[model samples]
Target: MSVEHIQNSVKDVIAYLNENPQDALSNDPPITAVMEDGLRCRATDEDGNTIVTDMPQAIGGGGSAPSPGWLSRAALATCDATRIALHAAQSGVTLDTLEVTTDSVSDDRGLLGLDKSVRAGPLSLRTRVTIGAAGVDQKILREIVDFAVAHSPVADGCRRETPSKVEVRIA
Candidate 1:
């Protein structure tokens, strides 16, 4: 999308939020994942969009779809890109190129419960972003990226601990 469009959209949302501050607090639509077979699962959102996930063959899965860890990295990449775009648009900069790559290091010992001291999550995460805009100063672009990274919701979530409670239902 063009920077002008993004700017106008951001303006509209800011105006809306200003007028209706109560609407600012919200929850994402509930997602449900059902196992198809083995370690394969299909997750559907309220909008009917779905994603499939499976483990690798070494883990006794068919390796048919992206693993959850991969999806997590993808989410981080996309979210960072989005935040950068929004910030650039707000600053009236037209980007010529923008790319974000996310990677993480995970310990199998943690996931497999082989080590009690290891946490069952990524040990380290990194994001690489390539962005440029013709006629815009490199300093401006760096500032935009810095601002976006600072405000990135996904990045914040990944960096901090978010409390979650799970409830089980049996039928």
Candidate 2:
């Protein structure tokens, strides 16, 4: 979409939210996952959109699909990219190029439960972004990227602690 369209859409949303503060609170649809085969699962959202995940062959999986860990990093990358686009559009900066990459360092021992002291998640995460705009000052572009990172939802969620609970059901 064009930056002008994005800016208009964002402005409309903000105007509506200002008029109706209660509408600002919202909840995303839940996602459900079902195991399909050896270490493979299909997850679907309320809209019927689905994604498949599988572990690598070394972990006794088919290695047919992307692993959950990779999906997490992809989510972060996409989220950061979206936020950067929004901020740039809002700032009236027309970007000529934009790219974001996310990665993490993980320990297999933690995932395999071989080390009790290690957590079952990445030890560290990193993101690299390359952005540019014609006729825009480099300082302004940097500020836009910094602001986007500060407000990115997925990045914030990963950087801070959040509460999660799992329930088991048997049939």
Write down the lDDT of every candidate, Cα atoms only. 0.95, 0.96
What are the models' TM-scores? Answer: 0.97, 0.97
Tens digits of per-residue lDDT for model 2, 1-171: 899999999999999999999998888789999999989999999999999999999999999999999999999999999999999999998899999999999999999999999989999999999999999999999999999999999999999998889799888
Residue 103 in candidate 1 has what lDDT? 95
Q: Model 2 lDDT vs. the true structure? A: 0.96
Cα distance off (Å), candidate 2, residue 132: 0.4
Residue 115 in model 2: shift from native, Å?
1.0
Candidate number of the best lDDT: 2
Q: Write the per-residue lDDT of candidate 1 for residues 1-171, one digit (tens) a residue.
A: 788999999999999999999999999899999999999999999899999999999989999999999999999999999999999999999999999999999999999999999988899999999999999999999999999998999999999999999898898
Rate residue 156 of model 2 by lDDT.
97
The alpha-carbon deviation from the true structure for residue 34 of candidate 1, after best TM-score superposition, in angstroms, is 0.6
Candidate 2 residue 151 Cα shift, in angstroms, is: 1.0
Least lDDT summed over 10 consecutive residues: which range in candidate 2? 162-171
